[model samples]
Target chain A: MKWFEYQMEVDQLHASDALKARLLAMQPDSQTSRDHSAPAQRGRAIRFPHWRRWAAGAAACAAVAVVGSQVLLGMGPAGAGISTMSMTAGGAASSTAAAYDAAAPEAAAYSLAENGLSARSAAGADSAVAGEKIIYTARLTLETKDYDAARAALEQALAAAGGWMENSSESPYDNRRSLSMTLRVPADSYEAFLAAAGETASVVNRSEQADDVTAQYTDVAGRIANLEGQRDRLRELQAGADTLADLLDIEAQLSDVQYQLESWQGQLDWYDDQIASCTVTVDLREVETYTPTGETFLERLGAAFAEGWQNFVLGLAAVAVALAGLWPVVLLVAAAAVAAALVLRRRRRR
Target chain B: MWRVSQEELYRIAVENYSDSVYRAAAHHCTNPIDAEDVVQDVYEKLLRRKGSFSSEEHLKAWLLRVAINRCHDLSRAASQKDVPLEETMPAPPAADHSVLDAVRALPEQYRNAIYLHYFEGYTAAEIGRLLGAPTNTVLSWLHRGRALLHTMLQEEIEDEMV
Candidate 1:
């Protein structure tokens, strides 16, 4: 038989009607029936097996449990560790105090020796050297009944103490007149200037601070000495160079050493400027009556309530914005729910 | 996309595609019982599918692809016991038994390609897409299947004449 004849014969082949009817009568399995209850469930069922999904969920939960346990283990000993650290810190503090006490007499002797040594140094010979570098600053906030008399008295006191006004501002507002000035004085006269300035006005607040920069000054001095020594050695090497390359190499080393020396010199100059002058900020206010600026308890409570209400409104607006962004998703879910309900209702009618 | 309810869609799919799926599965499975199982499985897959078909042709193509895959899975199952094809397969009508037997005697791949091409009237390209093979491979299978069928049927005819 020809190919077309064979094709025609095979095309006539089919299953019996009884067998087709039997297959048509078959219903889905129990698991499939449960899946058919919801469209989302049906989609999930086709995606993966139930056991695989359960295994994935279990793995995720196990990971979370592991991480949580690790966090708990880390935090559990933190309290004990803090107490232990505090005890160690206290022990270190006592030891430091003992060491400071033992070294007190030696420190005094060293200061005297350093004063003698600095008197002979080039920078110290030009200006009187203190035993240690200290930047003294004082802030005096005063209330005065007579603004002009207090200001004149302060200027006289500043001149007598060998101090100059670095900055001065006078403000006349409403009924009050205030004068604020920053004064720079010789370090040796800082105490005398402060005492005299205190006498010129009724001192309401007085604060003095002394920052000792002896250690920083000594460190910079040592670095400068080291760099100078290197520069001298490079100069000797440059004098003895036999070849052009050797001379060039020595010159580069000398240039680098010189640059470092200049940088250290600049830092030393800044330290000298700070140490030579003591800064004093004096605020003299002319007051007709004394009025406190501190807020009462009732005022604080009212402010807190206002802040809380503002935060609540901001939270509500944030939620409204988030809901607006998700409107499309919300609409899709609503449509799905309605379709599911219709399917369920039709099944009931059937 | 289908606008009908899921139940109505399912009924329509079964009414339209059940016989064709069963016939194709019977060609592969050899046994009527296994073929029916395959038919049921294919329908179950269809019912659970989340997507809707673009057209009736698309739905038919999906059903045929799924039916072929189910038949392949059944054939490869470790627990499957080989039943004698002559005993388990229902005899075709007396006029067509010889030709049917000859067609069934071809190798599994050629038998599937031949059945899809000749019996279902699918082109080689369509059969290749359904079977997840290249079109040229389906064409080769068809050539070999036809050669084998012609030889087998001719020998049977010669024997009957003798």
Candidate 2:
């Protein structure tokens, strides 16, 4: 009755000895096809081949996923680049690898370079955008020497542009704090606000986009009008109902119409809000010095030397902190060594 | 896999670790023939694998993991196939087979944990690593599996007495 006896029953179960001989005798050259056994004809062999195929298919899918992600990060611009590049940017900047914000001339120049156009010629594409109902979005990456001054100036500029902070996050990088924030500014002042942000600090990168939503806005507005008409008709019908059942049925239909009307109204309101204001996301980095937009050979050399010096100082500090944390272990090892030496001295004297 | 040659693979798998792999598979696969087939597949994978194992224990663990995965696949396939209730109904166990039937009839999740813990002497921590679950979760699985096994064995003994 002992449950441990179950182990003996399990012990009696094992792979047949012939299976080992067969496995050892398998030719490596012949294993690639894995069709050694007619898998369909076997009593027990059929189950595992299904999983073998599944595992192989899974591995192939993993490889595809890896390559697909690399393509995304390599060629694709930042999220809104589809609309920006498609309409305002001549749709020829697909080869541009820089996907950051476009506040700096270098970013526009970067795209301009990829477009193989003359400097500042990309501006023609931006100026060609004439859509009345468009959602404007601007992303800026700035480097600042003084966070408090930069922040105060940012606040003053936001107030001037009639903008409000929507979402903001601040985190420290190597003892220096960096702030990322999303702001909503009136579309009229989006260009002025970005220019003001550039003056706050050294602009590292910038990108601008105009998403034309006129057709979508008109379609939603039309739907809202239809829903409102239906709701109004339903309300008028409720008053003219002839029987209790008709009255109740009309009431249900009226409520359903009211729900659809509100839903459509919400969509129309969202479109209106998007057209009225621009979403400006800014990344403000606090740096000891600005990175030289190295258009010259001397500037590039100076930046590389400065970076090397900074890295060497940081490495020394890291080693000092690491040794400081190992004091207890060092003490223990020292104590053991002293004790062992005393024992050896006593044995040698004896 | 090439680290161990053809003769070495046969010796290590058939003599050293095939029983372990077979036993791990058997905890889930009630059919002995299917369990043996899983063993052969596990060794076949080892032979074809290009990666070198770090140690003998690594080789054994690899075999066990492959065996368990194959058993999972086989069990899933088995579950989806239709079987009449009459065929699935457990026959009265022979006086000696009450233990095996009781063990075999355990719910699938508990079967591997119970067999590895009770028969193979794997602690909850070792079972946790083998099954890729947290140690605390493996402890609970062992606890529940043990309780289920005790109840089934008790019922079988009572029936035998009658």
Candidate 3:
């Protein structure tokens, strides 16, 4: 037979009687009285369709208006700048003088050496490391009455100065509370936020230390460069490997070299991260005690029980609904089985 | 609330297309149970999704796409696990029926195109869209499937007569 004829025959022969019966049983009836009554049980609540449509239309218009305003606002500054520049020469001079006056105090507050560590180091020895450029460390201790408020203010100052906290803790001792945050304030802002933190609390102690690792850095760099050259030679050997055995041998050697290189790179990166950013340790204490608020035991227990019960009921309801949907198929199967058995008994008697 | 009811959709799908999915899967899968599994999975997915299709053609096309994807996914997963095919498959009708077996055993791409063209009345272009392939690729598949089918079927007829 032709392929098409065979395909059609296969389709016909394989048509599932059971599937067809099930599909026939599932066909929806028009104006089905029993199904119509089910929807009526919910109480027919009419909604004005136009109201929702109008609301959606209004929302779209509002969104367009907002976008239009943002575009105009973005263009406003550039437009204003060009118009001001094109104004009378006398007026332009007055505007320039006013702008400079407004910018002066902000510029004065940030010293070039104080705002950038590279700039500070280039000026001469870093102020904090002037005497001992090697083996120098700085320690600061601050005391505040309100630990949280003092910590928040210190954090804000650190963020404004592009600084980071290394370690911080609140210690309880008698009626007085204390906080100590080890902060790595920007070398430029080290003097500024430190002074500000001191104003927030009392400055108990201040110390600075520096350590130079120039020789160590140079030694490690030389070793890494030598190893990288060796590793590159091994890679060339691996690429030119003629036999599988030689390839495997080269791979083993390459693996060892790569491992050592990665270890050296990790150590170098750690050293670089530490050298790039200076570390400052600050110890702070509150002058007053910290007292935490309390909640009743029964209230906490009751809330936990309520949440557990709600979850349990929801899980049970989901399972019940799933089983309910499957019940129709189950019932249909049961009825068919009973009918089949009855027919079989009748045929046997005949 | 909708023009086509879920029950009607379910009925039409099960009656007309269930066996097609089963036969397609049975050719790819080893056993009737797996074939049944594929059909159940396809129908359950259709029921879960609320698709208001424009016509019966759209609905049938959607179902076919889902079935083909499911079968392909199952076949790929089966291959990955290094499953021995026959353990999951029924024995062939006999050596005499080699052609029918071989045609059924042709790879998924060929089987699908041939089946849709001959069984579901799909043209090569229609098959291309359904299979996410070019029309020429689908035509080649159909031609290849026919050649494979003819060889296998002829072998089976000779074996049966002997």
Candidate 4:
């Protein structure tokens, strides 16, 4: 009744010689037959035909050609006509002055042309603000004796500077009474707001950054204009389509172009919003007593050790939860290792 | 890049591994015809795979895994009906009938474990990896399978004596 003896018995039972020969005789050509039949069954599930794809591609290329011509024409002397519709400096100058009177003298001479947008300074008269769209951001960390009073003062400062809080959070832990807020203010008031915020609490840290996004914004705007022209051309083609297949093909192109236009339009709107407002991050914390900046080396070492122990316990808990989730797989692997070791040991003994 | 033509590679694979794949499929399938279908399916998949094997052992393991999966798929197919083993296969010679019948009558999982462990000489862990079961589960299958086979064979011998 030994398993090895029974293994011998079963090993003797195999496919008949005829079946073995037949299986071995199978050729790779059988796959060709299956492949040929598979497409026929799959064709019903396919939405687009070969000819339809080619037709759609051709229509797209034609629309692109039309849009390309329009962009080229607009960039030439005829571009003045396109610029006149959106870039009347007189109206923009007045609006800019009304928005922020402090920067009015600089905005009065701003102009938009084929190259890009630029601003001319009145006092220097020779100096010109280069054609660059700059987004400004400021980070301010403050320490105050009263967290609530500091937070209230910061909100009032934002309102006075024509800014709105974009996001805000208060720490839930009792040991650390802190408030964090992100505010969006008119670009002209960015420095003024930072100065006002400094009055609310003692400034512990301050950082300012300016990012140039002129090229990206201009590229997205140009793409949106091109896609809009393409959509219009596709609509015209749809009107001229005579056959059902031609109509469907044109409609598909129209749908695709419209989707692209909407996506680029969203990007343009985002750029406009970002360019109009500067971001200011404020961090306020309550400090009971003012402590000197200097600390002993031993004190720093003790703090480091405490932080390390906390992280170690947190890491151990994470590992325990992960292992609990994969217990079945763990058991299988453990059993496999034990079985493999036993098999190797038995082989050696023999 | 493969130096050999696809046709040449297909020929070499069939010549080298077709019998082993067919035997594995036959152990699980209800009849020879179904087993043949599983064999064809496995070979077809092998031909269509885009990746090249690292070595001969890798190729053999791939073929066995695919053959086992194809057998499972064929057995589970709702359109497939069980055919009598005698109808699909010619009667075994008198000497091998007792053992063949007993092996074939065992449950599918136990039969696969026994065939792979003993006939193929695979260790329990290797069989576990192939069947996607724990090593202990495979060992349990082998143990219960042997106990069942011993009882069946012993009963047959006693009947013959009677």
Candidate 5:
């Protein structure tokens, strides 16, 4: 035989005819055969009645309307409320919005007033400027076995530093007491106040914030001054002889300008009080029981089992409720899906 | 005069040409099951159509066209599903298998031409009609397949010589 013929023979041997025969004999799965025949019979059965279809369409429209109306309501005028809240001082004293640090106090206050305004405005909230006095607040948390001793030390420290408790709360359940107060210690006595408060508590956590409202205060004062000047001019015009209509108009304008001047003065005075007093929030945790007890392995295992059972039951209930709520939609969608699947299978067979 | 219902004609067509169609499809599909499926599908198509053909040649061409189309369809569908090629193909008949094996091992275009020309005894023109290719193209595929076979056989002979 030629070289070509010999190679052909070998290749012919390696290529198994049995494999092809076996492949030919293979049949489509029973499921596929059944699925192929399924759609030809009941595709007409699952369709909804005309009235039901109309009802479904109406329901769908109603659902869309309800959602649209809800979104509109949420965005309407009622949604607009106070955009910002300002905490102002009660007196003319400049209240520092910032904690007093040893560096250039005036420069720090200036940057704070400008930067604070920008930051608050960026946050879509109103920003207030404080006067020259910087209010520094420190919160002290203490956990002590000797509550009376801790209280006595704190009181003495506050008295020595001219700091007093503004508010105090005691929880009966745990014997845990907390005190929150604004301390109006002079600028020089701030360190002393901190040290005194530190002696009463273990000083678990402390945070101090500084706010500069000088620019805001000055702006308000300047506005009040300008409005007063305008009001004065209006009054002078009122004193001079003028037409009745002009007098009424001038009086109205003067009232408006006076109202603005009063508003500015009110804002300026509030900022002044904020600078004068330092407000601090303190939380104290009492060590009522410090003894630690070990749990047995069985006890821990039982707890884990209980937790697992509780979670499983809750999960099952939630799933059941969800399925119940969605059963109508699920059934309709599933019927459509199954019908589509059967049709596709039959098409493939052909 | 011979008379047969359209259904009988369909049955007759299936019985007579199904195996042939399967063999033709098997050459391309490399899988016996897929070949059988292609044959069945071809018969189904024949049954679906109005009973009309000018001659046996036309009928056979129609069956061949359906078989070839089905084979290609099966190949494409299998590729989309990332199915293993071996699953759809059956083992070729064990006895006298070497011929079929050698025929199938050829490239897809080459194998189809050689199978139709040699196994089915189709001229290049007839293959062109069935394959929807130009006669010259069918001839080229046959020529190239033969050349490749010759080279491969030659290599085998050298291996035996060693």
Candidate 6:
């Protein structure tokens, strides 16, 4: 047969009426519930639905405008700079500013002075979610005068706080030793653990971060529930399956569903483990001097002067070493000068 | 550049491209039921998709690609069972049976080239984009598929079957 005949033959091959009927009955995820409730609407076509989108957009725009205006106006009346905002003690300023708005912006700003400290009040918002799923992690860089004493005290502190070294490595550089460790402690003992670590060795630099995984935990939990329902339904279908082909198909689907169920369950379990314990990576180094926090202005001035004098002495030593390193070149120049002098003297005598 | 709603696009796909997708899948599948499953899966995917197609042609190509990929997955999954093609495949229309059988026998790579070039009327370059193959490769597949189909149908088309 010609290729034209072949095209005609293939064109004649249409999907069965049953399959088309099934396709026609299918609804997308967004419309499934609504279509199922009103079967009469199944045949109707819903276009762009502009009004719905416009309504949602207008609501979002209004929300952003309201929040933006309040924050801007609140800052103007409060007369507090960005630096002061971080040092304020409480959320009183933010809350009142958000609530009262233009009616009494000054009253809202005054709450900042009442709140006391601004240092960590910004991040204190998560204090409300204390019972929620959060993964707390901290990184600490520490220094001590003696390596053996610091290392022993570090282990004692970890034991005191019910923490254990999950991983550790120690190395020596320039005759001084440094140790790095990942420690895991119960979430409840996290603050105590930090304090204990500070007592063991001076914490040079410290940073802590909290990952709020409550939303993800709930989402994965929901997926696991749905997968469990699917697996159970598939099992029911399997028991009732009559034909060999039907049984095989169901078995394949069952395995797939089971695999997905286990995967989601595994994820939820991991979240639980992370929420239960906190991971802190600590770096300990042997230092001759400690950089203490909360120093007086006078002490800082004295330190600055001492550092300058030390730098000057080091600079002179560096120059002297450089001159000594060029001795061979200096000796060659001196020898040339002597030979030239001897030749000049011989010519004068002649 | 004109925008069509997702629901409208979906209805259009069901009406226009369903048979083409079914045919594409049927060529690769061992049975018509499996082909039907692939077609169902292709439409379900279109329904679940979060983004809109650029145009009707884009939508059609997406359907064809998805159907072909699903067919490949089904074949891979059923490789161990090794069902006979003649027993599972439904009988085609009486007139041009030999022609389609010859085309189906050409191999998987040739089917995309042959189907797109012959039936869908896509250019060699368009088929390359659809199949994710180089233009030269698609051209050669079309060339080789045409030659192979002709050879397979030569005796039947020339005298006895004609």
Kindly report the fnat of each predicted structure, to 2 decimals.
0.22, 0.34, 0.13, 0.16, 0.03, 0.45
TM-score of 2: 0.41
> What's the distance in Å from true for residue B148, model 1?
1.9
Residue by residue across B1-162, what tens digits does model 1's lDDT show? 647766666777787877778777877765677777677778878766878877777778888878766655554442234444442233332355456666666666787787777767788888877776778788888877666765655442321110
Q: Residues A1-350, candidate 4: write the lDDT tens digits.
A: 34455556555545455654554566545543432112212211212236778999999999888656544432342234224423443343443333333333333333223114353334533322334455666777787877778888999999989999999988855444888899999876776888899899866556555544555666787788788889888888888999999999999888988888889899878877887799989988876432111145455334344434444455577899899999999999999999999999999656
lDDT of 5: 0.57
Q: Distance (Å) between predicted and true CA of A51, model 1?
A: 30
| Candidate 6 global CA lDDT score | 0.69
lDDT of 6 by residue, B54-131 (tens): 888999999998887766555544543565454223333235546776666657778667887887888888888887
Best by TM-score: 2
DockQ of 5: 0.03
Positional deviation of residue A130's Cα in model 5 after best superposition, in angstroms: 12
Off by over 4 Å in 4: A1-29, A32-350, B1-9, B78-97, B154-162
Residue A47 lDDT in model 4? 24
Candidate RMSDs in Å, in order, are 21.9, 27.2, 33.7, 30.3, 25.6, 40.8
User: What DockQ does each prediction reach against the true complex?
Assistant: 0.11, 0.14, 0.06, 0.08, 0.03, 0.16
Q: lDDT order of candidates, best first?
A: 6, 2, 1, 4, 3, 5
Better structure of 1 and 4 per DockQ: 1
The TM-score of predicted model 4 comes to 0.36
lDDT of 3 at B57: 78
Docking class of 6: incorrect
Would you list the C-alpha lDDT of every candidate in the order shown? Answer: 0.66, 0.67, 0.59, 0.65, 0.57, 0.69
Off by over 4 Å in 5: A1-98, A103-133, A163-165, A174-188, A288-350, B1-162
Report the CAPRI category for model 3.
Answer: incorrect
Interface RMSD in Å per candidate, to 1 decimal? 10.2, 7.4, 14.9, 10.9, 14.6, 12.6
Give the number of the best model, judged by DockQ.
Answer: 6
Q: Candidate 1: where is the Cα deviation over 4 Å? A: A2-24, A27-350, B1-4, B78-97, B155-162
Clash number for candidate 6: 8
Q: Report the lDDT tens digits of candidate 3 across residue range B1-162.
A: 237777777777777777776676666666666766666566766766776777777778877777777676666555555666632233334465543455567767887786777767788888888777778788888777666655555532221110
